[model samples]
Target chain A: MTYVTDVPEMAVAPAGGPPGHGAVPAADTPTQWAAAYFDGYSTVGLLAVVGVLFLTVAFVGGRLLRPVVPTPEKLLTYECGVDPVGEGWAHTQVRYYVYAFLYVIFAVDSIFLFPWATVFAEPGFGGTTLVEMFVFLGFLTVGLLYAWKKGVLEWT
Target chain B: MNDTLEVALRLLAVFVIFLVLPLVIGQTEHKVMAHMQGRLGPMYAGGFHGWAQLVADGVKFAQKEDVVPANADRRVFQLAPAVALLPYLLVLVAIPIGPDNAVGEAIDAGIFFVLAVMGVGVLGSLMAGWASANKFSLLGGLRTAAQLLAYELPMLLTAASVAMAAGTVSLPGMLDAFEWWWVPWQIVGGVVFFVAGLAELQRPPFDAPVADSEIIFGAYTEYTGLRFALFLLAEYAGIVVLSGLTAVLFLGGWHGPFADELGWLWTLLKTLALAFVVIWLRATYPRLREDQLQKLAWTVLIPLALAQIALTGVVKVAIS
Candidate 1:
């Protein structure tokens, strides 16, 4: 009984391949597809479990090892040795929100660009694919230029 | 039986990464930064070179008082450090440590998985900041979110360009693509990835989110004891993951001069080199103003990343 590596075999299996011809048996059922997908991530799942355990041990060990003597002054929020000021909640600047909005635009652009790149490298793609990508990029460039001109790009 | 073996091996690797690597890297960072500042760091801890300094620090952190602010949101505050550290571990699951020593079984979208998980760390910082009930913590958290959002674009774009060049988003596949003619063409994307990665990791020049002098350690301002140690662990873990990703994406993961049997060593060497650069940057540079960081990301790095994508497209077309 030879051991099987999971991912590469599953990835190379044609969608409708004949029974017993691939690592996965022929089953058009959604359960089979889901199982295959889950199998691919099994190692990751194991690692996640280990990771949680590692953190739990560290936190628990620290709790046991550490002293617990909390004074009221120690529990007060730190303010550069000054006495506690007003409420902890303060009005944050809107500039950070604006950066997030700008990030959203480019993030979508990147999402589109990744799939395009993967498709562009396919055997049949050529100069036409290249031109289409540039056109897509052209729209993004225009948006960026608009943002630039409006000084949204300015950190101030 | 094979599946169990594979799982056991991966668990050992994860243990090494989570438990051991951080201590070694943290020590190296202290010594390197100290040397840069013209001081001998940790010289007496392990007898000769203070190699046991990290061990001592760990024990000290373990023994310190765990404090929570009276007005703080207890649940979020308690959980933030774990949240921040968790993603770093998840990212490691997808990282190919060597040609043959990849911890987990390979996922086709390995690099994408890493980037997406890394993005989750900002939420941890945000939680820490907002739950701390400190104004400085809030500011730090918000700044962290903004900075991560700003830099993440260029980092993704640069990575996408590398993916396009290699024609594979899988970590091991990218390594296989580095046969001879690939390195020179990847130089631009590589540089962009490094610079944006620095911002993503919030290391020097780009560390405004945690500027100690400005915000008293930012989101970590109110954290004490073991929780603070966890945050520091998260940071060092972030550095290790980013450095490993850099080696995989640009410097060719596990591929170096000499024996193929020693591939993991090469990967370690490359990762340490990149991590040292990060520590060097922290030692040398002053923190950039928040606005300067934003401007650098949006105006400079983003455009350069876009241009790199265009250049990669043209070169790919021409060569094909």
Candidate 2:
């Protein structure tokens, strides 16, 4: 092992070693651009750009040309504009929101759980995934238990 | 030239299904629901139960005045319709509408990819809801988010089980795996996925987003004219999308009972059958209470889904 060595620059290395093996040869700027841009064809990058251009035109064209006539009655808020009484929008109980938030966490947990179950049964994967799943379940259970203890699970 | 022409034709076919079919389904749904309820839905719009209803509706929507509230955010409000329409179109990118599940040779990962795309539609609704500046609209948006969170899991779990039993994720691969049918292996997931799909699409019993009695048309309270119409179209189209998704995900899409050939007719029949069920459910069931809905999803549906996942894993292991 060479413990103390200075790295050589690409300008200093000689080319071509074993045939059939890929060699780390110096790349030109334009060639690199061609490969990356064209999928090594003519201009693969142009397609993506063209797609974006088309999308932009569609969006802008629709927005610009869409017939819009601003009138008084048309501008009012919908649903007959019922006045929100009693502390208005902000005064509603937070319980529903909390339930939804907790449900989201648990639901997402279950989503991942399904895929984990599938991979868990394979030869090499079953054990690791099983352990991971149980641990993951532990956190979810804690959340469920927290909700249960708080009586958030019970509906009036 | 030939390849390009083929692609153009394929795209035209896709547009016909994606853009055009929703209008047909919308009309058919109205007629069927009307007949079911012992009423003539629309006999005047064109010929026989308003065959030309969609054309009239489209023109009316286009000509209607565009409305924007003084308090509403212009950018998000304007972006909402386009945003909502995009995801439906995007899912078409991965969806296998016809026999081959054709995305240049369907991959094994089609189900998961479509599921991911389905989640994005709610984002547009949320944007619409928030931008409207009305509390009702805001609440509607939140409900949409919550509704999706509730159902998306069961649907994913159901698909995962099907994938496990089929041992592949590709639509065609799943088809090949179970040349007979893909339904029996995932009946539990199918029921769950269907109900979850209803919630995902905001159908009855899960129509909290548009619970007209309580929230006054929910997320779209502020929209008018072409914008409102697009959202309306999106809703019905969304139902078609959901129906199609449920069919493909569970019922062995394009795989009819007859000898092993799947054509456009088979796809249309299967999708319509599922769409009929959606309309039937809407006709039959009352909307679910939000709390009850969340409870059902969390306590019952999710646990049941877990047991299913466990059962699937165990059964597969045993069989293997």
Candidate 3:
């Protein structure tokens, strides 16, 4: 499908091209301009389309090649060697959620660390950057210490 | 036209990663694991050393019965394996296989892109467990979600430290950052990445989710035929992707003797060596209990990773 035209007439004005020269007059229209903007992502879009197609083919091929054999016994939920009892859903521990919460805290901290790393290496920013990062860590350390003291770190 | 050709070539590389490497690496794991256990592996499958064992296994899996449990969520059960497998292929698109052999477009945030995409496979496992309508599968699925989430923190922290030290998160950019001196500074981060990566991959010592004896293959307990094959494929592919990531992040990716002429070979060598280490860990270590696994991640690895990041920051400040 020719979703975005490749012709230069369909092209929006270059970022700083001469005012009226080579700029499509229709580019002022939102739909056309939006399509042009989206043209940049066409490659990624194509990749996704291709990926979905590939998966479809694999699943279809498996369906074609594989046999379908079903019996009541064979279709029963597996409970090791025993007969299954009750519904599959069961209460999961609350601790998993706690761990997830702790992860979020650290995850945010790590994200902040990335930009800091980039800027910290710039000239004359070293000492102040180091001190600021330590202060940030001191707060994170306090949170961690609280988690530790609360026995949230214990896996039991 | 040029962009189309690049995307096509990248898709071809993705095909090779998904289709070809798994067979070779899976066979290597089989033979290696067999030897470690004091037996010959796949000695008779193909003339040499059962080198074609994976191909044979593929055919067998292709023809086996596709059985879904009576009580299972039929649609999700069927879709879970594909969900698991596809993300790894997408991840390959962002990974540079060699110095100049990046398959997809160079993403500026390549490392983060990889970590983000890789995490989606957990959804597939969770789906598999929930859809199977089996208690063990449910338990396994829950463990996968918990374990993966827990391990991902240290893994991301360690990778962030690498990105920090290298001053870029792009795979190719990090490769460019590698110099002799950067190695010493990254050792701690490198070790953390490898360990946490192993946990993320659910390889041994961290494989509680699929502990066969305890959980009957966990999330995969009810899978049969090609569906089961897809899960196994995802796993082996995950090993390759993680190893490649480890190589790119920590080792000087595609950098070796004569790397300028044929850097892809060095990248392959490093990836295979790391994969071997993963297999070695599988053979040597006993599986940690669920609590021990969490304890190690929360207490040991996370703190060490945080400290390593601080150290990386200090060192970068000191050097610059």
All candidates in order of DockQ, best leading = 1, 3, 2
Per-residue lDDT for B216-307 in model 3, tens only?
88999999988899899999999888888888888887888887777888878888999999898899999999989988888888788889
Q: How high is the TM-score of chain A in each model? A: 0.77, 0.41, 0.68
> Native-contact recovery for every candidate?
0.67, 0.20, 0.62
What's candidate 3's i-RMS value?
Answer: 5.9
Model 3 chain B weakest 10-residue run by lDDT: B99-108
Local distance difference test, candidate 2 = 0.67
- Report the alpha-carbon TM-score of model 1 versus the true structure: 0.93
| Clash tally, candidates in order | 0, 4, 0
Residue B35 of candidate 2: its Cα lDDT?
91
Give the per-residue lDDT digits (tens) of candidate 1, residues B116-139: 899897788899999998999988
For candidate 2, give the docking quality class from DockQ. incorrect
* Model 1 Cα interface RMS deviation (Å): 3.9
lDDT of 1 by residue, A5-92 (tens): 3543453344444456535544345654544555657767777887788789988998888889989899988998888889788876
- Backbone clash pairs for candidate 2 read A38-A44, A120-A126, B108-B169, B108-B170
Per-candidate iRMS values, in order, are 3.9, 9.6, 5.9
User: Which whole-number lDDT from 0 to 100 does residue B163 have in model 2?
Assistant: 70
